[model samples]
Target: MSEVYAARRTRLREYCNAGGSAAALVSRPANVRYLAGAAPHGAVLLLGKTEDILVCGPSADRPSQERPDEALRVQTLPGAAGGDPAVAAADLAQGQGADSLAVEEHHLTVARHRALGSVAPRLRLAGLGGAVEQLRVVKDEEEISCMRIGAEIADQALGELLESILVGRTERHLALELERRLVDHGADGPAFPTSVATGPNAGRPGHRPTDRRVEEGDFLSVCLGATYRGYRCEIGRTFVIGTAPADWQIELYDLVFAAQRAGRESLVPGAACRDVDRAARQVLDSAGYTEGLTALTGHGVGLEIDEDPQLSPAAMGKLDACVPVTVEPGVHLPGRGGVRIDDTLVVRPEADGGPELLTITTKELLAL
Candidate 1:
């Protein structure tokens, strides 16, 4: 809604004013979308002291589904020759008499930042930092609703995959099929690259799928998420390939499950982000499997798959209500393959409920 974008921009403008900037140029796609309601390719949002404008380059097809907020003016860069929208936005900000314009240094390239300066030397360029991302960490109900739907789609895809034959399928095929199922279940697409790790690759975080085929007695781990209406949620599970799991397999699965549950249970308002990681990491460390543990037990997820409030030992932040994060702690034992259980959940007040689980897929170590 236009009102939603307006409110978000108002908040961002307040942040800019607090930082002594008269205007802000949002060039990052996610930040632009968060503030302007839509970010077409090469689109940049200018939150000015007087007028908020969405600048776009020439495009054959505008994303009609993601219309810019009616309250904001949309300006296309002039002429048949395409130009950088951020540069044009800076010029517009200068025209509006904005003395200083804050920009996301992390998102903008050195060349692009220099281009903005070239266009409007009078407008002081200040670093916007991660202000927009910080604002996005705590989501509204509407954003959480999209993530909930995405989690459901991911669970449905994973459930369907379990019912299918997996005796000899390649990891790449499995990953692709899961992604297709995500779309079939009404997802815009997979939130991130679908990971299907088999055998020794199981429990390896961010492992790219390869030609390894599923085989009996191998541990299979799948990490996937779905994007629903621009919101994302992740779910990961590890399963044994045979009708029964070996003793070592059972032990490893149970240990990882406990660690994941500990991390999930720690998703309460006011909990320190690192303490949550400690809750999960300690489980593996005590079990003598600390060497190959993932750097973070979990991370915040929303418009971006991995955003703010990182659940790592070195992280510094507190979880707040409506913050959606994934507790994905895993251990990889090199040649033996290991376990990883992950779920996306929204932190809520204890009176209403504890963390709300979006991904309902069973954590039981399923033996396929």
Candidate 2:
């Protein structure tokens, strides 16, 4: 497993050499894990030209192999307990004859950047800039496997909810129950906050779980996901309460469902990020519910819940194969309610079956 990390480091070293940097310091937790296999809390990775090192905080003694940190050279030489690992990584890079070091400016605070400069006066500091993030956009089979498992865990949790008596349950309680089920099914935790909006609160994007009890003739929308091995995926479903649904509720659910399908169908390799978002946004816009639309129709999922290639109007770049992203388009009408359908999928070419859906939870609106 360390060999896997060694190979990853070798590739990054090649990238650094090509970019004219002697070495690079990876301080972002996800990037550090990608390069070194394990990133202790507050640890930083120094990808020297020859040897790679994981510098841990002074007080950190326990290290786990969730992703296998043991594959890289470990250094528990933090200058002080809870001290900045980035500075120590910069010092190590300087000692290794690295004249120039690249750092993640977006992830590093200004104070830490200044400390690195002050600690290593001779070394030139450069921006690593989105290099690691770019590498992460197209995941390997191993990464997709983690996301697949996470999606399965989330589906199981949602499936169990369908069997229970949902009417009269508080939104907050249902959300918490789903999160607990995710953990019981072997997930690291919820990918994001579990959203359970009942009655008038339903269908809202990012709706915080409210205290409202489920009422008959109301829409119940739920969105949730689980994180496994640092990989995350999302799933959402909107349901009708009671034996029969109202005409307005059916119309809103169908519109949102179509928007979600459009977004999912647009998940092809080489599709523009904004174009995919537009595929869904247009449906809701023409329906006169465009006033409170969320900024993004969907976004990326991986080591972090929200990553690059944002499915928004202002986003740039085209989608690529092996990229795991979510397509969630939703609509929420104040005082009335709304509907949201979401799923995690991987962008694939037509030869390999267009887009591979990860979250397989039923999308058909069910009456509960």
Q: Per-candidate RMSD vs. true structure?
A: 1.1, 1.7
- TM-score to native of every candidate shown: 0.98, 0.95
Clash list (residue pairs), candidate 2: 38-69, 203-338
Separately for all candidates shown, the number of backbone clashes (residues 3 or more apart, or on different chains) is 0, 2
Give the alpha carbon lDDT tens digit for every residue of 177-224 in model 2: 999999999998999999999888998888899889998988999999
CA shift of 324, model 1, Å: 0.1
What's model 1's lDDT at 353? Answer: 85
The candidate maximizing lDDT is 1
Off by over 4 Å in 2: 61-69, 78-81
Candidate 1: lDDT over CA atoms? 0.92
Candidate 1 lDDT over 59-111, as tens digits, reads: 82444557778888888876687889999889989999999999999999999
- Residues forming the 10-long window of minimal summed lDDT in candidate 1: 59-68
lDDT of model 2, residue 5 = 73
